[model samples]
Target: MPSRARLKPRKMPTQQRSKATVEAILAAAAQVFRRHGYAATTTDRIAQRAGVSVGSLYQYFPNKDAILVTLAERHIDAGFALVRLLLREALAETPPLAAMLRRFVLAMIVLHEHEPELHRVLFEEAPLPSHVRRRLRERENELASEVSRLLEAHPEACVRSPDVTAYVIVHTVDSLVHSFVLHPPKDIDADMMTNEAVRMLLRHLTAEGS
Candidate 1:
């Protein structure tokens, strides 16, 4: 018998289609994970929600955790991007430092209010795996660097070093927002809390290099 002829497999889609598939899967996974946390979310469910087969899901994500990590990356990147845009816009408007800080605080508060559920998922529900945490740390460092650059533009400020000051300011604001969402103080009015936080942030940043 003559040797059987072999047919080469068709070439896979270009990188663009692969990216679109990954994005679609991540988006669907986010919806499912949001509705039903990590423990309850399943690969099959993600595939179904994504309008793709299990095999296709695996092509991009080995398992559910991979999808969660992707979502976390996207969310954190988005959050930081929003901060960058807000700061840039405020800078363009040449707002006073105190006013800019107030706007920053309000921006975070509004973000929390705008997507409470997603914020909860990001802050409360989803556990930041080691890899995700590492990425977040890098983002934090970048944010600090950006803040330092921003502060350098304000050379008249009393603060001597922008790097350290930026880190402190970013972390302080993060702590305040996290605390507000987790446990609001009873004695302080919500509006007053935001106001006080903004004031404290400005005072701390502007205080004579103690």
Candidate 2:
């Protein structure tokens, strides 16, 4: 594993060209990682795939680990963005709990399904930098906090401890959705998985005498 300093990007891309170059490199890295897996991937392959020279690649990222960290950061940011978007839409319409959960579950399944192979390499094969792991935990907690507030505001959510219940729901949905998408069973499709997850959550959250 690389040291924290070694995992940091050497420089930030400020100029338009540099920013594009960085984006290309990151995009290429994602493809290379997906095709080659983390252990087999090399910086040379990423650079070639990006159509950038090794020196140019090194200018923005110190090494492959740095690029991986950036990719992980982008993925985390995107996931949170989607979650927030769904939450906002739900709040605006104040939809039924089942409808809201379905939206969230289906969105997550679709997001993971977009690039399951890439995600497998990023999350399972590669070693995340310490900072990236820390950021993930922080983001999960932040998301849980947001969900707790939402549950508190909702009239039907009769959970005794909204905070703890929100945390459980968030993590449960995340873990189950990720597993269902990435390692789906032969018999279960997206619709079935989504319906089952929503049903289970609704039962727990809106259970009789809860």
Candidate 3:
């Protein structure tokens, strides 16, 4: 027998390769879905695009739907990270409520603008499988809670119902920028949209309420 180190340490079998191959397949599938739309995408095409065997694809993701769920999970996690960065950066700065909120919202919108494709996949896509949906929902709630906690620390900010308000702010700002990602408004420049969204968020979270 050859020395253990030189023995080419038994290559990962079809099963282990299946996991990495599946990830590549999913990545390819998401691009295909985005480019061709979900209805037109096929597993064989995804496997071909990923440079993996179709058998390898099936070993991991059972079907196209399963791959979509994987893609959704990826987008959700990425979105959460983007939002979290904004929250952390804004909160770290010395505060007057309006300015901090504005900065945070601007940062987040800019992030969306930077990667609209991923943002679209996360927010504009249809329902995912139940388990993935639950996970995404929980992550959304958790991010909202984190923002609320940050706001709550600044009682002078006078955020009414911090939990509710945080959720509303997050959802609203996302929706506003999300539109830019989904449909580039002809008249509204992207920078102007970012500014306007920041203004809107600041007005809500920090401006005097009627």
| Candidate number achieving the greatest lDDT relative to the actual structure | 2
- Mark the regions of model 3 whose C-alpha exceeds 4 Å error after superposition: 1-16, 110-115, 118-127, 207-210
Off by over 4 Å in 2: none
- Alpha-carbon shift of residue 69 in model 1 (angstroms): 1.2
User: On TM-score, who's better, 2 or 3?
Assistant: 2
Name model 1 segments beyond 4 Å from true: 1-20, 110-116, 182-190
Write the number of the candidate with greater TM-score, choosing between 1 and 3: 3
Q: Compared with the true structure, what per-residue lDDT tens digits does model 1 show for residues 1-210? A: 111111111133369978787778877887887788767889899899989999987765666766666677777788777877777787677667777777777766664554455556766776656656787789878777767776666644468778988888878777778678656777876589878887787777777566
Please tell me which model should have the higher lDDT, number 1 or number 3.
Answer: 1
TM-scores for all candidates: the values are 0.77, 0.93, 0.79
Per-residue lDDT of model 3, residues 91-174, tens digit only: 777577667666666656665665466456545564445666687778778778877877887766566588898888777776
At residue 168, give the lDDT of candidate 3: 85
Every candidate's CA RMSD:
8.3, 1.6, 8.7
Q: Per-residue lDDT of 40-146 in model 2, one digit per residue for the tens?
A: 88999999999999999999888898999888888887877777777777767777778877876776676577678888887788998778888888878877776
Q: Could you tell which candidate, 1 or 2, scores higher by TM-score?
A: 2
Model 3 RMSD to the real structure? 8.7
**How well does candidate 2 match the true structure in TM-score terms?**
0.93
**How many pairs of residues collide in each model?**
0, 0, 0
Candidate 1: lDDT over CA atoms? 0.71
Q: After superposition, how far is residue 24 of candidate 1 from its true place, in Å?
A: 3.1
